[model samples]
Target: MTPRRGGAAGGRASRVRRAVILGVSVVLAAGALTASPASAYLPGPVDDPLRTAGVALAADAAADTGIAFGACPKDSGLAAPVQCGKVKVPVDYADPGGRRIDLLVSRLRATGPASGRQGALVFNPGGPGAPGLWFPAVGLKSAGPVTRKVWGTAARTYDLIGFDARGVGHSAPISCVRPENYIHAPSPDPRTANAAAQTRERAKARGIADGCGRRSASMLGHMTSADMARDLDVIRAALHETRLNYYGVSYGTYLGAVYATLFPRHVRRMVLDSVVNPDPQGVWYGANLSQDVAFEGRWADWRAWAARYDSVYGLGSTASRVQASFDLAMRKLAKKPAGGTVGPGELHAAAENAAYYDQRWVTFAHQLSRYLHGDDKPLVAAEAPDRSGAKAAENGDAVYLAVQCTDAAWPRDWGTWDRDNSRLALRHPFETWPNAWMNLPCATWPARAGEPVDVGAWSAELPPVLLTQSERDAATPYEGALELHRRLQGSRLVTEVGRGSHGLVSIWNACLVSRVDRYLTSGDVGDADARCAGHPVPVPSGTLGAKDANTGRYY
Candidate 1:
């Protein structure tokens, strides 16, 4: 892949590189790692005393590649000293010399003994669109479950590295709709909307696609999982490593599986948390439909939990009554939006985040109860975007649509989409239509879709890898993880029995965390489908810790 000059606009800047891998530029410029180019691969400590201790540089491996690393800016938010770099890779692997884009990368050196140091541990926090540049920093922190459970022994032994994938944060991003379009636009709700409302929704989807084509037409077609997997290989080579060691959560599991399939021998030790389905039929459409069912089930779980503490919450004493209260809230929001902004669709979007993590259950329930009692401040605050960095948030949403729509073929027939969503909406009204509208741009997506990776084949040549999933996960259902385990030979599937949250590995399950830690440290998990009962269900009233609501796993 050739690295070409990029058009200057927004926060993007162009960087030039010599043909040779050595002598790559490393300038510590202003702002985030996304804004400037850094030095080529350098081994050892650069700055920052806290992180520089016991560091080992991969200068021997990086010397041959056209990649460099330099110290990050004063406020990169990394707990340790980290070296940041940029890699220019082909937009399309089929034509390596045709067009190119820079991929932003950051690395934190291992703090363990050099002799015992494992290679770089690559991380993807999912989202197919979430920025991972700060994830490694999260791993380095001394506090929090993510640092303890997910990172575990790997945190001490491996160089924790994170990168913003193609068309995502810090990497050349996909900017589709204008920020004004997102400000107060009511999300489409086919399940309850009138004929006129439905028409507006359909137009919104089409409008999103048209806007994407107008702004990012040339790069839209190349944002597939396959393209992303290829980028991982380039990063691995630049890291001066022969094999890839990965920890992928949510959508990142699919990305890791694709890399393993394309380059099986290059995989050393992998941990896929919350696995995506390997079935071709489920790539884009079936998987989402399945989520509707799973999310409903998870919501039921939440209702049951709420019922257990009805004396405190006062919503209801039974699951049915609690569900009724929720239904009433939605109905009220539909008739009159809270604070003149949060309609039924906005309420759904706000509550959807709560469905993924149990800790947020109290916050959401409190906010809803407050709204019903004639206060809209909390509800409006929930609906408001993070203005601290609106551009970053907008970029994430744009890349999300760009990658999901182009990764695999969505039904070209709007009739098929409409029929499926309409059918699902009958039994699964909670997320069916909202999810459909979120992805509706695919029906008229300007870019053609790519062939999905064949992930069902069981390859015996690859080394043993570990997989974890919650039995009641809402995003990537439990069945997908089982199917993935069945398809991938020499892999261990550690099941968090009865855990309803997505990204089960290190949130709060001690059994799951111990097993993952052992695997990453020793590269061994005895059984093919191991089972472990996770931590007890969180109570509604108490300030229980183990909260990871904002970690941004793909779900």
Candidate 2:
């Protein structure tokens, strides 16, 4: 999950944008594909599951009633020439005629010639709730060099498609609380909460769950990734594509995997980055626990980086000393929150970004230094709870819980959670408690949990898939990628050795980028798996800019 926090100011946004543009420009310069007819790579056959469900293939009718692409919706944040459209799909594929929801989709049409056009390349930016309508623009706007190259290559031969999954973004969005009431009330620091405080935290989690049931119960049950995968088929037929070319990051990898399992023949080329664990047993509860351990390691990496620049940051000269400094700062914040708004929880939330991307290490170190020196503004600005985007954040959080909490059965007994999380927290204190609380709502999720798709069931039937991961990715650890690779019989795995970043394709790693570019452009997966050296640890260069600092909560 992409941890939610306030973003950096002007410096970060400009820097992120510049990085994106530079990466995209390089990608556009890569070699192009030889001309080929679009029909050359049509899907072979429909799986029995889809064929049996009469409504499943009903979307094929969309071929006759194509999407009406027009001016992009103002709220979509898309610029001119990029068209927006909608496709109506059943809220429940099991009962296609029951209720329907509109899926908001955007398209950046292929820029290359008609004969060279491959088809639509669908994208999912992985929140399980992150709005993806802005994804197509990400290639031209903000991703890293290699990611941009892959996008650049696709843009030349494919019409890139981005959409808000059902019950998210502009597609009949669901929210558990109203913006004005969705305040981030301070809670006791998770790292130090006692039994009574733990009980109170559970109550808070239960309250959130109850609120979701009360406010958006109608849509909660339908938010599973399985249903979302079905929605993708509807989108495929609507676009008149015989096969889907997909790129999924984070939670999106799971969605793509489900789609491939359900409709194996309908997939042409697929790229899954930062893969989610495909083990049915680890559906989500176990996955989050695993993340706790991984995040701590990444956090340690950040502290070590800070120690390397102790003269610049004045935190400490050794990783242990940096940890001590961080502990001292936390104690001070516990006594009195910076700016009276950023308490321990908020500060942790802001600093946790360091675990997700090394790009934020310098900025976070600076924020910590400033806070310790009595200038709390940077720390405050990094995590002060903003109410303006509360509705959007609430919607994303609701959907995240709606999907993850219901995707698989979570331990109903609060004691199981308390025991497991407490045990893990003892060894990995960085994000254990915070993550446990973030997912605590699952203990009493209102909807009945659905069984995760048997991801490996149709693995042998799938075409070669390309998988990428940074060895130390915090969100979806490297082990998940290995597990997924083993499950997907013929898939290729590209490991970014020693890196800890969450998403690989969006970073400026040339080695991984070239591999992805080659696969997407020529459908080559070589004879075996591949490895790429990770980009070196970023050195503090006079406090370079950050990325999407103000983007609301994501998972």
Candidate 3:
């Protein structure tokens, strides 16, 4: 799904690319997991695939999309969802009267003081490609308490909107290759040159992207931040709101920015989590560097923890020394691909748990230790998506690339990538080439490049915006947040210093909650340097509580 970039002004963390969330749903055909033709335009509905409640479509332009005010099942939990009906938007907004596609919209009425209702605080988990539909229903652990209040306990207070983008989720799938080709195939070998691995990866990417272009013609082109902004308008019309109040994380930040830029008056309040810097090359470069650096820092944390158990695990004391050991394993794998087929590329892909999700820290540490000592069994098992979806998530990786590539122009010449990557791998070889290979589809994505939005960070006319970012973060990187704050003359940045993660909202930070709640409720993010909790002492292995296991009492 690599889209030939039209060339966005912002790079990885800038443009409305997908947020750094967990897997795309496997709800397509058997074992075919996917996200968007490009991305679940606004990913609120991808994860929350609760069987939709068959409700009548909005009668007119300003009909109600809210269901909590209507009726819902009494029970809560797995069965407890506001449930929604489909509202169709133009497949291509350019030709509104032509073809149509469904945007799965849902809202859990406000649970706060009804007398003091704050309109709708729409939730977008930033995927331009992520399916955020489950934000309200299942709460994928990142929607934060602000969202919980909306769909809290049940549909007591707020109205949440979680829709799969035009080509994502139950709306309509875009898939090129089946998961078997990627998943069932051998894991990567890390030691050798990454370029050869990238070639195979490109083949898999094209299978998905070209398949999407072939399957959905016009829909493929409509998969951009610009058009999705139009979809927001349609969402507004259906919601019957004069303005849209939004909460976006990761790429969701960009989505909110786009919506605000396109329809400033339509925004009542917007909270962009994990702020993206609008500088195209610099941001992606920063994002790449940031991931390498942050992961390295976290790698140290993993090493120190391993040190505490030095007697249990043979890895050395310092993070640097432990990394040396892991590097040795990668070299060995490069020379002799494991599992009879898996290579360095697949091995790194399998080990990507370190890139996101703190839950995997212990497992990865233990697995890496064993793999270094010649036990490849648990490593393969460690790489599976949590729950296999109804079917394979279709075209997710493909759609991810398609939208990204088409959304902006990436360097085409393999030479450029060769040189750039050689440099990146030199400094941050841990996840460097593997991460580069993950995004290789961008090199030859099928779609025509679209234009990147040159967005302003601040504006006098806009309502107060809250920008939350985790300092020392991977992926989106916190430095970009400062740039966004600097650019957005009126924007205030609340930092989660040293958290070492992306999309700093959720995961429990009192400072972030205070800043965001103030802004959302009272329409203000104070003009001070607001700081959230920095990184805490690294949690030890076997100390992972219920939350890490996804068995929280709340869940």
Candidate 4:
């Protein structure tokens, strides 16, 4: 996703770009797995016996007139032995003749026996800014177990496809600031009474907004979700598929929902995990407020779990005491950042991940315990930004803001932001301020906002869509999943009872795994939504008092 930039705005542009991308990266980086390199290509139109007899098609379309699949560039880091290519799509679909942007696409052929080839399944890791080129590898490795059980083979039953969404990795990314400006700036501390620090945070937000406007003005207005949905259609056409089979998480779920609304007939077996609420009123801003409250609840849950394992973690024997210990650690880090870099804010970014995924709970507790014991090394390492001179040619951070800030009109009035955040902080303290400041750039963003797509309903006949969500998910709360199911007539919702993990299907929790697998493989779900028990809460690996895992009970 590398794009060469003119050297005119070198010094200031670099600084601004780094700061903007880093801020967006920290918050949006949840749920997505670490990236790995792979090569892949777009499927060409030429008819072959294998295509007609083997791969399943959701619908019939004209012969593919798409770019020929070709070898990936040498430095592509795509070592997975797949095909890769670039598809040129209109930068703004409204003005198709205006300009074009190249989207980097990749595909992994179905590795199952020829008799079992299902079709192409598109995978999105959900950041809106997250680069999905590594998804094929993620599916091959992490999802191998689940796919193996469902299809009777390990590689994959369908052609696993991944791409860098527009303005993301490998796409024509939007750049606002330099990578160096991604330092630990002070965010508004809900507990902080310091007016001066609050002013600085506001200034920081303003600077990022202005920097992006000045540096990436041309790319800003064109990065909305509507445009991204249009791009998906182009990819579908190029792949010669009449319909799309998708698995989207977090922000990706929003993208998936929008796609289904815009092109209902073009869907086949869509799976939306950690579903986003598609209510027009909450297109981008209100969801963050929902996240704040949800994260706080998950934080409370983590504390209680830690108290239950007091013999191993020694944080406390009760939830309140465990929370106090965490507060003490944050205070210590605030006085002096651990390792001179990991401050209270950085620690929040690192530890907050636990609120979204249960698997992170044990590891985060261990790190917090060690931090209390004077080893902030792990905390610092978890969020250290890339200082390496090799910055991304098209930073995902820039695009995240571009799409979100432009997706729907964000409140332009700073006073509105201040009042709303202040009010929300009283009840939702854990993430309210940090999350507010993270998105505050939208208040003064340079992009021209687009009309938000109406995703509430679709009149066309659509495939049976499967929606999944953990009951306590902080990122995309469970209510959003129910809302999406309601919007999409006949869609089935699967709830992970008492769980908070973000990405559900291909992970642990056999109950969730079985439901999603069945939906994808057979396209058959109950006439309504189903609820499944969560994976058992985990304790420190060697805890002697560990009860029967399925019970998830401390005794």
Candidate 5:
């Protein structure tokens, strides 16, 4: 396949960027490594020397490539027969051995005896930082019981591959911002009375952006989804797949999009969920605007649900009251941050978490109340996503920042950032500024930013692929789902109405799961625009109480 080039915009950027991989900082797996103009492929450390052994979990030989893999034995949280090892990839594809960095690979091969099933399903949870190294083991267990049974026969059919992208997990880490850099004080004003803080936040946001120029400055020039896409192909070549069948969520959708665009013919039974819009403009700032809007919807949803626990929260009898109390807490936080470190950014960080799922709402409300009235535990342990294993997400963040900055030029002029934040915050004060701060580093990235790859969506040469999406997803937003569908020629979009989170497949809704199963097992992607409408949303309150409700209520 010709390596498609990208340029200034994802369209124009497409002309300059080598079409090998895609990018993202979400779901299970995000970001693919690629080659650059400068030769910089450094090999990585080979941990736990690979030993050839036959085990139930790790495969000795890849199905398609016939590449031999030596199991690097290790263990993670889930006690599955665990195998850990390293895949030596180019640090800079241009220079294969300048500085080697081992990419941590893990696996939880198919359970049960093998019948002939399709090959391994590579699962990426996004987060660019999420620990995918451990997911293969967890996926086999968590795909629930049935996926296992199918995969068991399918194991004879396929194998499982989990990899940590550059600077993530077991890979050489790049910790740009230390935990000490984070502010964690409680808010005292309850009205955002600190004018000093707003200015400080802006300055810090700018500083963080500039810091990238110092620390990962050279890295900034090379980190792009396009680069990572190339790295995946090396892996595919190693795995020996004639084509790759991938499952990506949130940012992974972007990864999958770039891959399908670059190697359309190599795609087999792909799933892009809670899709990311492949638009380059959206890639820079427009995407965050969507995030602010998406999180706002989630915030509203959380507020409404808090009403049920009014007695426990004492925040309100209705969701509105709860929202007010939360807003008051933010105002208070703005005045005096938790431990004086966590600021408006931190407050909104927790708010964004509430937007993630219902299981987390009570904790968000309880913690917000504690911070408001006078407590620090809940506030300190706020809405942050748990990233315990291998510190994969942390490493991914380093790599994510490096590549995203290298891919494009963010507004380096502080005024532009200020102006943009001011405008977005006016409407989306919830997570707007924090989201801005999260991506601010892109502005002053040190590396000479390259062009973005024009994701070639209209690929008639590509085989039909399946795309799944949830209605109220905050990360990717439903609009992106439609836009992506518009790009892929032979693509089939299967909608799961009113769903949240990324990659809702195999989670539930037989209607949705079955489509994925049929599509993967048999190369049939039913008629255009197939849908599992009005899907029954999963409620935390259990099926019985859910059934008893007058019915407008959601868990």
Candidate 6:
């Protein structure tokens, strides 16, 4: 379902969260392998050592003459006149001659003259599972003014390429549990729920893991980031591009980093927004823990914003009062769900949107105030339970687990997860438990774990890459950008000081868009890192309506 403004999937916030969960698992799978030289493909650790082999296979794969453009699928939801097609790629790179699958692709050809063309600018919208078939269209119709200007120039200079990475969207998608069987309600609140409730959550996680094993055993082992990176190379060859020019957001940053590590020489120009921490020790598990802390801070930011507009929301005149109001609502919802749908779990999920973007704060406050005042219609409509796209949602979740579970080894003992998350929940009450439960299936993932690519090993061989980040980004914290900057020796870092938005570049903030546009258009990596002051915090219009809402679009 297309998300409404100020509602669920507020632009890319909701969708980006789904991708964020899965993308968090991507970096955790790398083993402690030494970096490879630019000239050689180094094999990862023995747990899943096929990375080098996969790169070799991708290199040897036959080049496609070209993709034949045709009408996109009627249900694609892309407004631009984009042509959709598919290319066959081996399901397992190590066994290139074995089973093959279709990789769905979309493209909006450059409008400029042939001499001005700079080749394909491929995009991945961050989910290890999120589909990109609609990304090019998003650039055309949804970007902010500054971004629109940049995108307009890009449309004339590059063939904007978008694709559903394998096992996503229309590209041989995989599902673990049936739609009816899938569990959508949030797990019991770890902060207040009893041990029995938590145990039940554990069992639920196991059931999901078992279901995935039973249904998609063959694909589970092959769904690692390294494998996806191989698929990217295949995409590059099919496009007939000598070097890859890429843009990746959220988890896509990790994917792009992996691609660069694997094929440094083939990279032309790259942009990584909302950078992921490539530290092997922090991969999936530690990363989520860090995310919990970061989210808590963003939640505070939301509370302060809501408090400032207390005259409109009537929730509170101070941050602490705002928290109290929100907590009281949660308590009441636990007893009786608003509209018989938004229980404690759904309410928490709805409220979490505030952590991703400031634009949603007003909508969130409006919905919360209405719920407290006995009006549940808007809240219910905005955060209703998933029904129409239950199967597709399940597919994304399935791939999320598939890649993360096998990418790196998770703690096998439930005690470790309980101990770590329980201690963390005490300090960061906002997302610790819910985030832990969302990823609990990894403790017993069915596939064999693989080693992560040593992301820093070949940084020196890479072309000058650009990194953009917000100082207060909750999804991917600012420290990750610094870590990546240090790792990629020549990469330039652009910081949006005091901003909390998850995704940047063309969503808002003209300063960031200008830097990104200059890099894309002229290959200019400034002599030093740059910082831009964040846009002012949003103020409510005092009237709650669709007009005040920002559509889910950026990521």
Best-performing candidate as measured by lDDT: 2
Q: What lDDT is obtained when candidate 6 is compared to the true structure?
A: 0.77
Model 2 C-alpha lDDT versus the unseen true structure: 0.78
Q: Give the per-residue lDDT digits (tens) of candidate 1, residues 234-270.
A: 7786777767899999999999987787656568899
Q: What is the lDDT of residue 381 in candidate 3?
A: 64
Q: Candidate 3 on 1-555: residue-level lDDT in tens?
A: 223323332353222112211122232222212321112122222112211000011112224332223332232122343555566665543223334667776555565567667666677776556776555563433445544533342233346566666666656655655444445434556424555766676676556556666665556666777566667666666666666778788777776776666555456778888876655554343455556655655555555656765555566776667667776767777687666555555556544555564545556666667777778776656543333542335455545655666667777777886787678777666656666666666666666776666565225546777788877556676667887676566778877766655655545454566666667667767757688666443343342211232212210
Per-residue lDDT tens digits for candidate 5, residues 337-373, read 6665666556766666658654455566667766766
User: Model 4 over residues 448-483: C-alpha lDDT tens digits?
Assistant: 786667784552467778888888988888788877
* Candidate 4: stretches off by over 4 Å: 1-64, 73-76, 139-155, 185-193, 389-394, 542-555
Error of 4 at 1 (Å): 23
Candidate 4 local distance difference test against the native = 0.69
TM-score to true structure, per model: 0.84, 0.87, 0.76, 0.83, 0.75, 0.88
Clash counts per candidate, in order, are 13, 3, 74, 18, 82, 10
> Candidate 1 — what's its lDDT?
0.71
By lDDT, the candidates rank as: 2, 6, 1, 4, 5, 3
Clashes of 6: 10
lDDT of 6 by residue, 164-198 (tens): 98889899888889978775553234345357878
Local distance difference test, per candidate?
0.71, 0.78, 0.56, 0.69, 0.57, 0.77
Q: Per-residue lDDT for 483 in model 4? A: 78
Give the per-residue lDDT digits (tens) of candidate 2, residues 17-90.
Answer: 45544433333343102112211112212323222242332464454566999888887788756889999887
Q: Predicted candidate 2: what Cα RMSD to the true structure? A: 12.0
lDDT of 3 at 476: 71
Better of 1 and 3 by lDDT: 1
Model 5 ranges with Cα > 4 A deviation? 1-80, 95-100, 139-157, 178-195, 206-219, 308-314, 331-347, 366-396, 503-506, 533-555
What TM-score does structure 3 among the candidates reach? Answer: 0.76
Off by over 4 Å in 3: 1-78, 138-157, 179-182, 190-195, 198-208, 280-313, 328-347, 370-380, 384-392, 535-538, 541-555
